[model samples]
Target: MNTRSFSFRLLAWYTCLLTCIFVLLCALLYLDLSRFLEHNVEQSQVRRAHQITDTFLATIGKTGPSYVAGQAKALYEPEISDRFVRITQANGPIIYASGMPKDGSFDPAEVPAFPPVSSRESFHRVKLSNGKTLVIAALNYHGPGKTSYVVESGALLDPAELNHLVLQLLIGLPVAVVIITVGGYILVRRALTPVERITRAAEQITQHNLSERLPVSRTGDELERLSISLNRMIARLDDAFQNSKRFVADASHELRTPLTILRGELETLIENARLDPEVRERATSMFEETVRLTRIVEQLFTLSRLDAGEAQAEWSRFDLAGLAKTTAEQMSLLAEDKNITIACDAGQAVVVEGDAARLKQVVVNLLDNAIKYTQSGGAVQLHVRRANGHAILEVEDNGVGIPSEALPHVFERFYRVDQIRSGEFEGAGLGLSIAKSICSAHGAEIEATSVPRKGSCFRVTLPLSKN
Candidate 1:
C-alpha cells in the first residue's frame, strides 16, 4: 500500500554514498603518501650528513682543539649555525669541528649526542637538556665501530605552516563535498527519468486497466528493457485476465446443461413415481448425466494439475513412429465402419524421451477424434518423423474440418463442434485439451489446423532423445 517511487531517491542516495566512500579513501591515501615521501627525503638527507662526517674523520685522528682547523675539515662552513659536526679520536677528544675549527669550548655533553639515537638513517632530532632541538647524522670512520666523525643538521618546522596545511584540507573538503552532492543528485535524477515514468505507469494500472503499458524509449539499455518488460507483462496480464473471464463464462455454460438435464429427470421421476418404467428410465438418464458431469470435473482437475506444474512425467526413450503406427492400426476398425481408410507412413525410428504411456494416450485420443468426426469414406493418415531435433507426430484426416475462428478454441477445454452434437459422435470435448496438456508436460507442443468440411491435422512435436 505504501507507494513511494524509489527511482530518483535510491539513485541519489547511492551516488552520495559512493562519492563519500571514494572521497574518504582518497583522503587517507593522500595523507599516507605525503608522509611516505617526507620520510624518504629525511632518510636521504641523513645519509648525506653521514657522508660529510666520514670525510673529516678519515683525515684527522685522536687530537683535541690543539689540532683544530685540520686540513681535512676545511670543507664544512661554520656559517651553517644550527648544526654541529666534529671528528673525534681516542679518549673522545674533539680534534676538528665547524667554525673553521676555531678554538671554542663546545662541550660534548651540552651539544647533544652526535647522531641522536635512531634505528634508521643514522639520524634524529633531539632536544638538548638546555632546550634546543638538533638533527644529527653520523658514520664511524678511521676507528673501531664507535670511534668516528659525526655530522649533524637541522631544519625547524614552523608552527604556522602546519596550521596552514590543515586549514587547506578542511576548507577544500566541504566545498568539494557540497558540489559533488548537488551534481550527483541532479545527474542521478536525469538518468532515472525513464524509471520514474515506469513507476507512475505501474501505479496507474489496476486490474481493470492492465491494458495500460509502461512507456518505452526502446534505447536497448537496461532501463529501456525494464520498461519494455513491464509493458509486456501488463499486456500479458490483460490477456490472461480476459481469458480467465471468458473461461469462467464458458465453463459455467457447459456445466449448466448437464445439471439442467439431471434436475429435469429428477423432477419428472418425482412427479410420476407411479409409472415404474418411466421412473427407472428417468433414473438411468440421471445417472448418465451425473457420470458425464464427473468426467468433466476430473478433466478440469487434471488440467489444473498440469497448469500448476504438479504433473511429473515418467520419462523414457521410445520410438514415436511405433506408437503412431500402433494407434493408427487400432483405430482402423472405427474408420472402416465409416468407409474411411487408415494409412500410416512411419519412418525408420523416431526416438524421443518422454512419458511413453502418456504420449500413446495423446496419439489415441487424436486418432479417435479424427475417426469420430471424419465423414464416411474419408481417410486418416498418421505420420511420424524426426526433424529439427524434434519427433514430429502428425495426424491428418479428410473429414468435417473446424472453422478457422473455431480452430483457436479447439484445444480449449469442453469445446465441442456444433456439427458433432449427436450423442454417438459427441464427446466430452476434453480429448485434445488433455492431449495438449500431456504433450506440454513432456516438453512438447501440439497444434491443430482445420478448414470447414475439408480436413484437419494435429501435430505433436517432441524433442528427440539423445539417449
Candidate 2:
C-alpha cells in the first residue's frame, strides 16, 4: 500500500545497481573473450604456415620445388580445419592451393600480394569477392641457392562462437537479474522489519497512550539510534501532557472559588437596604462580570477534561431532529431582535445514541453563534435530517463570513478571529471549543466551511442509534 516506503525505494535502487554492474561486467568479459579467441586463431594460422615452410626448406637439397609443393599439398585436411594453406614462388607461380574457394573467383596464378613478414609472420583479415571473410597469415621463406617462396595460410572467421556467447548472455542475464532482485527485496524487508514494528506501535499511541515508547533494537545501527531518539521525544511529550493536565487542574481549583465568593458578596451587597442606587448598580455590574468569569472557567475545565479523557458520554437514544428544533426555538427571540429569520428544519425524527444534554448543548451553541453573527434582516437556517444512517445538523447564516485564514482555528480554545469586533460581540471564545469537545465525546464529528463575505456553515454528523 505504501509504494514509496523506504524498503521499496532501497530495493529499486539495488535492482538498478545490480543491472548496471552485470551489464558492464558482461560487456567487458565478452570483449576480452572475443579478443582472446581471435588471438588464438591468428597464432594457430601463423604456426601452421611456418611449419609448412620449414618442411619445404629441409627437403630442398633432396627434392625439387614441385616435389616440395606436392608434399605440402598432402598435408591439406578440409574436414577438421578452417584454414586454407597455399604455397607460391616469388615469381607469382602458385605451386599448391588447398581448399580453394568453390566460387572460383580466386586467381591461383596471381598470389595475394601479402606484405612481407615484419615479425615471425604477418596476419590480415581479407574479404573475398564471394563475401567470405578470412584471416590470412603470410611468411616469406628463403630456401637453398637464394630461392624464396611465400607460405600463406587463411582461416575463415565464422561467427558461431560469438553467437553462442551472445545466446548464453541473452538467456542467462534475465534469470540472474530476477534472482538478485528477489534476494535484494528480501534483505531490504528484513532490514526494515524493526521500522514496521515502530510504525505499528506509533499508530497505537494516542494522547491516551503517550507513555508508550517505540521498541528499540540492539543492532547499534541507524535504526537503533532512531528508536532511541523517538523514545526520548515521546518521553518529552508525555511530560508536557502531564504538565498541561496539572496546570488545568490547578487553575480550575485556584480560580473558581474566588469568582464564586466574589459573585456571592456582590449579591449580598446588592440586596442591602442601605445600599444606594449607584452602589447597587455597580454591584450588579460586578456580579455580571463574576458570572462571565465563572462561565469561562467552567468552559476551560470542560475542555481540559475532554483532552485528558476524563469525560465520558452518557449515551441515550433521543430524537436528534427534535433536539435541534428545541434549541432553535430558544434562540429565535434573539434572531427576532435583529429582524433575522431563524428557520428550523427538524421536521424528521432522526434517532441517535449520544448524551442528550451534551447533544442539546452542541445544537444550542451552533444556533447561538449563527444568530449572533447574522446581520439584521439576514436569515439563519437550522437543518436536521437522517441521511446514510447518520443524523446531520447544519447551521448556515448569511452574515459577514469568516475569513479563510481564520476558519481552521475557529474551534481552537480561546481563539477569536474578529478581534476588532470583540467590543460588540464580547466574550471569551470558548463556544466552538466546547461544542467540538462535546461532539468528540459523543463519537461525532463537526466541521465548518466558509467563504469571506459569503457567510458560513457548520455541520455536525452523529451516528444513528443501533437499536
Candidate 3:
C-alpha cells in the first residue's frame, strides 16, 4: 500500500485513534476491577473482625481472656489460614495475637498494634517487610461487665488474580488491534472505490471523446455529486468543441470558391503575352500563396470532419502492407527531386479495417514528412508488418531529427519545429495533425521517436481485420 494514498493515511489515523481509546478503556477497567476486588477483601476483613469480637471477645466477662484466646486458636485457626488477629485492652495490654502463619507468607510479628479508634470500627492498610500489603479492620468491643477491648483482623493482599487479568488484557490488545486495523483498511478501500472509478473515467475523456460522461452513482453522496459536476463540465467542453469544429468547417467551405476564382484569374493573367514582367512576377507569387492557403483550408475541413466522426462511413478491409507500398512508391517521385532515395518493405500482407482513403492519406502524410525533412542523398524507409494481431507501419528518415522536446507535439495542428522553420522547408503544419485525427477515428495509434542529428521514426499501429 502507498503510504501517501488517501486510504492508507485514513487507515493509519483510524488505527491510532482506536488504539488510544482501547488502551484508555482497558486502563480504566483494570483500575476499576482492582478497586472492586480490594473493596471485597476489605469487607471480608471487616466481617472477620466482627466475628472475632462478637463470637469470642463477647464472652470475656463469663470466661477469661485465656478462654477466648484458646477458642480463637482452636476454632478459627488464624495462623494456619494466613490471617492476622490481635486483641488489646482499653488501657494498653495486648490480650491475644496470631503467631507466624503456616505458609510463612508474612511474619505476623511485623504487624503493628491497632491505633485507638474514635469510631466503633476502623480499617487500615499496612506494607510489611516482605513486600506484601496487609488490610486490617478493627472494631471496639464492650464486654458484659463494661470491659472494653479492641479486636483486629487482617489478611495479606494477593495480586495473583489481578496479575492474571493483566496478562490476558496484554495478550488480547495486539490481537484486537490487528483485527481492527484490517477491518478499517477494507472499509476505507470500499469507501474510495467510487473515486477511483471516477478518476479512471475522467482520464479517458479527452478532446476526442468530449461527448462521453463519467458514470454517476445514485448513492446521493459526495461521489455522486462529483460525478455529476464532472459530467456538466464535460458537456460544456463538448459544446465548445462542437462550435469550434462548426466554425472551421464553415470558414473552410466559404474560402474555397474565392481561392478557386483567384487562382484561375492569376493563371489567365500569367498566360497573357502583353503583361509587364514585374506584374507577372507578382501575380505568380500571389498564385502560389493562394494555392498554399487553399491546401490548408482543405486540410482544416478534413480534420474537422474527422473530429466530428463524419469520416467513418467508408470503412473497408484492405491490405495495410500493400497500401504502404503503393503510397511509398508515389511519394518516392517527390523524394527523387531532392536526390533522396526511398525504400519500401512490404514482404507480407497485413490486413486492417478502416476508411481506405483516410488510411492512404495517413501513409501519404508520413512519407511526405519524412521526405521533406531528410537531407538530399539521404534515404527514407517504409516498413509494413503484422505483429501481435496489429498491423504496424513505420516511416523512418535520415533527416535532421526532431528535438526530444518537440516530438510529443509534432502531431498537433500548426506545430512546427523551431529549428527547421526555414523558408525552403516552410509549411502550414497541418499534414501530421490531419493524419493523427484520421488514425484516431480508425482506432489506430500514431507515435514518433527520434535521436537528435541521427534520424526519426513515425510508427502507426492498427488492429488487424478479423475478417
Candidate 4:
C-alpha cells in the first residue's frame, strides 16, 4: 500500500475512528453489565429475607421461637443452598442461626449481626475470608403480642456469566476489525475507479487532439459535475487553439504572393549588367533576407496544416534507410560550405509507413540544423535501423551542443538556443518544429539529447510497416 495515497489516509482515519467507537461501546457495555449483575444479586438477597419475615415470623408467637427455627431449617435448607439466614428478637437474643454451607464458600460466623433497631429493610455487601463476596439483606418485623424480631438473608456474588462475556469479546474483536478493514479498502478502490479513468483520458488529450473530451459518468454526484466542468474548459481551449492555427495559416498564405514578387524583382535588378556594383550588392542582401523570411512563412503554413491533421495524405510503405541516405547526400553540399563531414550509415533497410516526402523533409531539417551549428572539420552522422518492431533514425552531430535548459524546447516553434542566436546562424528556428509536427502526424516520436560543447543527437522512432 502506498502510505501517501488518498485511499491509505482515508482508511487510516476510518480505522482509528472505528476502533475508538468499538472501545467506547465495549467499555459502556462492560460497566452496565457489571452493575446489572450486582443489582440482581442484592435484590435476590432482599427477596429471601422478605420470605423469612412474611412466612416464618408470622407464626413465631403461635408455635414459639424453637418451632420457627425447625421450620426454617426444613423449608429453606440454608446450609445446602449456600445461603445465610438468621432470626433474632429486637434488643434480645438470636432465635435461629444457619450452620456452615455445604460448599464452604463462606463462613456463617463471619457474617455481622443485623442491627437491632433498623427502622426499615436494608442491604449491604460483605467480603468473606475466602475471597468471596456476599450480598446481605436485613429486615425488622413486629410479630403477634407486640413482639419484634429481625431477619437476615445473604448469598455469594458469582461472576461466572460476566467472565464468559469478557472472554468472548476478547476473542472476537480483532477478527471483526480485520474483516471490516479489508471490505472498506475494496470499497474505496471501487469508489475511485472513475477518477483514475478520467486521469488517463486527460493525459492522452494533447493540442493535436483538442476536440477529444474526458469520459463522464452519470452518477449524479460530485465526480460527474467535475468531469462536465473539465470538458467545458477543454472545449474553450480547443476553440482558442483552432483560432490560433487558422490565423497562422491565413497570414502565411497571404504573404506568399508578395514575397515571390519581391524576390523576382530583386533577381531582375541583380541580373542587369548596367547596374552599379554597390546597388547590386545591397539588392542581393535584401534578397537573401526575403528568402529566409519566405522559408519561415512556408514552415509556419506546414506546421498549421500538420496541427489540423492535413499532412498525412499520402501514406505508403518506404525504406527509412534509403530515405536517410538520399537526404544526407542532398544535404552534404550544404555541409561542405562549412568544411563539415557528412556520414550516412544505411547498412540495413527499415521499412515504415508514412508520407515519404514529409519524412525526407524531416531528414533534411535535421541535417541542415547539424551543419549550421558544427565547426569546421566537425562530423555529422545519419543512421537508420530496425529495433523492436520500430524504425529508428538518428542524426548526430559534433556541434556546439544545446544548453541543458534549452534542450527541452528545441522542437518548439520559434525556439532558439541563446548560443546560436548570432547573425552567423541565419534561421528563424522553425525547421525542427516542422520536423516534429510531421513526425507526430505520421504517428512517430522525435527526441533530442545534447551535452553542451560536446555533441547533440536527434532520434526519430516510427512503427515498422507490417507489409
lDDT against the true structure, per candidate, is: 0.69, 0.81, 0.88, 0.88
Which order, best to worst by lDDT? 3, 4, 2, 1
Residue-level lDDT of model 3, residues 1-467, one tens digit each, is 58898788899999999999999999998899989888888899889888888787887888888898888888779998999988888886788888989999888888777658789888888899878899888888877766789888889888998899899999999999999999998999899889999999999999978989999999998889999999999999999888988999899889989999999999999999999999999999999998988899889888878877876778888998998888888888999999999999998999899889899999999888888888899999999998998999999999989899988989989988884454568578899998888888888999999997789999999999998
Name the Cα RMSD for model 3.
Answer: 1.9
Cα lDDT over the full model 2: 0.81
How badly does each model clash, as a count of residue pairs? Answer: 0, 0, 0, 0
Cα shift from native, residue 284, model 4 (Å): 3.8
Residue 276 displacement in candidate 3 (angstroms): 2.8
Q: TM-score of each candidate?
A: 0.43, 0.76, 0.94, 0.88
Local error of candidate 2 at residue 180 (angstroms): 7.5
Clashing pairs in 3: none
Worst 10 residues of 1 by lDDT: 100-109
> What's the lDDT of the predicted structure labeled candidate 4?
0.88
Candidate 4 ranges with C-alpha deviation above 4 Å: 1-6, 70-80, 99-120, 127-132, 270-282, 419-424
In model 1, how large is the Cα lDDT of residue 457? 97
Using TM-score, give the best candidate's number: 3
Worst 10 residues of 2 by lDDT: 102-111
Question: By the lDDT metric, which is better: model 2 or model 4?
Answer: 4
| Rank by TM-score (best first) | 3, 4, 2, 1
Off by over 4 Å in 2: 1-16, 43-60, 74-100, 103-152, 163-221, 270-286, 329-343, 376-379, 451-455
